[model samples]
Target chain A: DAMVIQNPRYQVTQFGKPVTLSCSQTLNHNVMYWYQQKSSQAPKLLFHYYDKDFNNEADTPDNFQSRRPNTSFCFLDIRSPGLGDAAMYLCATSTRESMSTDTQYFGPGTRLTVL
Target chain B: AQSVAQPEDQVNVAEGNPLTVKCTYSVSGNPYLFWYVQYPNRGLQFLLKYITGDNLVKGSYGFEAEFNKSQTSFHLKKPSALVSDSALYFCARGIKAAGNKLTFGGGTRVLVKP
Candidate 1:
């Protein structure tokens, strides 16, 4: 199946320790996004990669960064994870079109636990 | 500032009963709406979307949403609710000028009783 996949479905990281979550898509989409979803909360967009162009949300904390080294893969790096960073990290991909009508496909998500 | 609001934090419905999940939005221009379902410990699955055309858009898993431009609402509906339908539902709207980023609602947890 051509779907989005995320590594380490459950991640355990110590407070102030750096961690990385990985995602890859077989869909071959040009646009990939990263979202943080807290318990019972909405999935908030952190950043995305339109090909090599990385776009970060203005309100996204500086500690979160993303890298799209190639077309099929994207990585979310937590510089120093905190307790508040404990959440489900979702990776989604969509075919890029200027029309903005395409729907996004999501991975199963990484549940991050910062202790 | 585009946004989506799911009025109820949770909705309880009995199996085989009709269900409605209300959603309202505020956007600068024409709205592009979407509905997604999230099972426990999983990512959201796209259910349906309304960009243009028909007011009633049918989507995956026998789900549908009605886009009412006059009322600025897009409510999800199912004729016969099932126990497996229990999950967290989120409504989202796209901001074209914002690089197609989707602003999601707080999410409404749906509980279908047997």
Candidate 2:
């Protein structure tokens, strides 16, 4: 039952407050990714970690940051949550071998609500 | 740059009827295509992928996709639709050198009426 898991399925934070969403995996994949998915839109890639190397998307905002402390854990940090930042944040994992074909497995997303 | 296009915003199908979700792509070199399904309040589940070889690829939950090189399209299909099959479907494209970064299309929501 190797799968990706996200903590605090639903999160509520005040505007301008910092919040962190956690993701852990049992799949032992070499890559971990964070995506922001607004209602009725495709999941947009925010950043990802290829092993220990962090890759950020060009359009990703400065308020968004990520950390991968170890293979199994990755965290997304929002330095200053905005009302527009309220969306479902998804974490996904994939092996280097399978990544070429885009076989990423996703965790249940964390829905963030900024008040 | 790799990009995907899902033309339809939503598709409506009757139960037991065949269903098709359209997808097209633009990428450098040979394209790698994938289809994923997402239920309400849940993460996306992989349905199938097309890399090489045969044009037709079968995947989980009786879903299959046909890869057309000439059309630059990979369309997902099912012989018989079920009510439980209703969900949001996404098409994505990946490049071999891009690691795990996938360019996804705006999703198409499928509604199977029972």
User: Using DockQ as the measure, which candidate wins?
Assistant: 2
List where candidate 1 sits over 4 angstroms from the true fold. Answer: none
Query: What is the C-alpha local distance difference test score of candidate 1?
Result: 0.92
lDDT of 2 by residue, A3-104 (tens): 999998999999999999999999999999999999969999999999999989899999999999999999999999999999999999999786577599
Interface C-alpha RMSD per candidate, 1 decimal: 1.3, 1.5
Q: Which digits, one per residue and each the tens of the lDDT, describe model 2 over residues B1-114?
A: 437899999999999999999999984566888999999999999999988899999999999999998898999999999999999999988766655677788999999999
Predicted complex 1: DockQ: 0.69
What does DockQ come to for candidate 2? Answer: 0.72
Worst 10 residues of 1 chain B by lDDT: B94-103
Pairs of residues at least 3 apart in sequence or in different chains that clash in candidate 2: none
